[model samples]
Target: MSTYFAILTQVGEAKLANAIALGQTLKLKKMGVGDGNGALPIPDRLQKALVHEVRRADLNQLAIDPANASQIIVEQVLPEDVGGWWLREIGIYDEAGDLCAVANCPPSYKPLMVEGSGRTQVVRVVLIVASTAAIELKIDPSVVLATRQYADDKAAGAVMAHEAKANPHPQYLSKIDGEAKIAAAIAALVDSSPETLNTLAELAEALGRDPHFATTIADALALKAPLDSPTFTGTPNAPTIPHGDNSARVVNARALAEATQGRAGVQGLSGANHGASPANKFTVSALAVTMRNPATGQAITKYATGALTADVAVVGANGRDQAAVIAGTASVHLHFIFNPATGVTALLWSASADAPTLPAGFSFFAYATTIRYQGANVI
Candidate 1:
């Protein structure tokens, strides 16, 4: 069983115990207030759906918190829709089924009661669910015998769904924040099965690699524009090009760092300045750039170590071959190209001035394949 479902079982046991021992009740809420169903309040089915989202903590038998074994119902959603899948708002109700909170993730409770009683006890409880959503399940396959057959490791669904709701394409644990979650998830999934474990490892690698789509979107949003032109070399190790920064240089650095965290930080940066009252620091990542020149004609420049340089003095408009990079002259058109696709006539995309520093394959913005599509039929 996945750690996710195992954890869910625990929560489920808690909820079941609370319902029986404390007699707490709950009601879930809908994403929007109303449509035409009068109150438009969340229906019990959806409430149960939210409840179902809770990972069942794997321990056998239900254990109720005697002190505060209160019934808790939770409904969850996202703060806003990002893309394909969206985690909606969550609703929590007390034993009496009253609104306790509306939030993305409700904080942990302090603790309700130490032990139970024939008299009464309010066992503190929490119902956790996803922030964004994709699909709903009426009958969870784990519990259902039919589903159990196909879902030997049912928890994959949760992790897969969550991963999908996140950045498109599988990513690796490269960034600081993503790495944390990936570590936790992978740890949880490791014992699931060898196959599952291997998949998780692959997921870790994917998450670690740069997703071109995400990179492109972030670049556009940073509002940082590349310099007018570049001087690239057909050489991979010593390509040279002219680079300059506008006033947005500093702001752009911060924005990019915020967007990509430190992965996109300036290179060749020194420590912060402690000389002044508050001191200052230098973020050179933004200043560093690799311009992707549109193809002028038919020519190829291989990316290598000696093909890159830090300064530019002159450039060759012929989009100089790889030889230009080895010399490292400033004024030149730098073309650092890597195409993620491996087919002939494949397109390419640029990350930094250097291409395929770590190569699985090439990078691409889009791919070409003949597909049939029907335009709006309404003519």
Candidate 2:
């Protein structure tokens, strides 16, 4: 029914027809039908003989060309049985039951021929068995079939077996077994030799305690000294006190004092005179005094003599007085004093019989220069 099969059938039929024509032509020439010069004339006898020869030539050509022979067999003898399923082989037979031709069927040929001959000549057809791979056949429920239900069923069994071989169940240790292992480990730690045990006891005493039982041997071996309990040998040397660069290096008080000879002593000033010198330490200048009115008891101006040439005037008051001579000689001694309470300076007559009186709250200031003599100086 495919177009490709139809085209192949057409090509086989055309080749068969061409072969039959060629065979008939050769047969006619051999029978002297178409040969030049004294060939058989086209009469009824020649025509009948030519037709018989052509039929015989076609049969002979069919044997020579299997494609033609198969075509003829399919068309004339097996026309009713030439389609449906694929044909493997085809056998053409004469009416006498002798095999005339055998042809391997083309892939496009269908198996539709009946086996034995009836009225027509026989053509045996061998059909290719239909494959159930492409066909879904219904199975009866009563029939039992053996097949893998799940794809991994067989593979899963093998995988489980391999896993069992690779990892068997572990034998677990009991609590008593674990305790026995720990006891054996502890027993291994205690030294059997008496000297070693004595040394261990001394070490324990030196540490002030026995070593703690540790889970690991390394932990047991790692002994640490107790805090604040280490015994140091010999006395530790005292730290040296660092002295500043400018500090004295003498270690004792007497050494320091000896090192510092001629230094100034404490609590007193050096290179100073404590008392007045033998020289006259006073000078003469203008002299003025303050007087008071005896009747009113109020202050009045009192004047005194100045040095050698002038008379002194009373300061902040109005009066003047000449020099005072004692028994024919002028008195030259003058005494000056300052009163901070009244803010005043007073010039006093050293030999005067009458003392100058001053008003309450009055002050004075004297201006003088230092007097130098050949034998001494006066300030």
lDDT, candidate 2, 150-248, per-residue tens: 236558878889788743443576779879988887677655535545466665765666365344445654454445665445653433323322354
Segments of candidate 2 deviating more than 4 angstroms: 1-171, 192-379
Measured against the true structure, the TM-scores of the candidates, in listed sequence, are 0.12, 0.12
Superposing all C-alpha atoms, what RMSD in Å does each candidate have to the true structure? 31.7, 47.4
lDDT of 1 by residue, 195-297 (tens): 6336745765656654575786688766644465544346424322213323333343333332332221122322221222111111111223222222221
| Alpha carbon deviation, residue 282, candidate 1 (Å) | 99
lDDT of each: 0.29, 0.30
- Residue 339 of candidate 1: its Cα lDDT? 45
Give the range where candidate 2 is weakest over 10 consecutive residues by summed lDDT.
Answer: 26-35
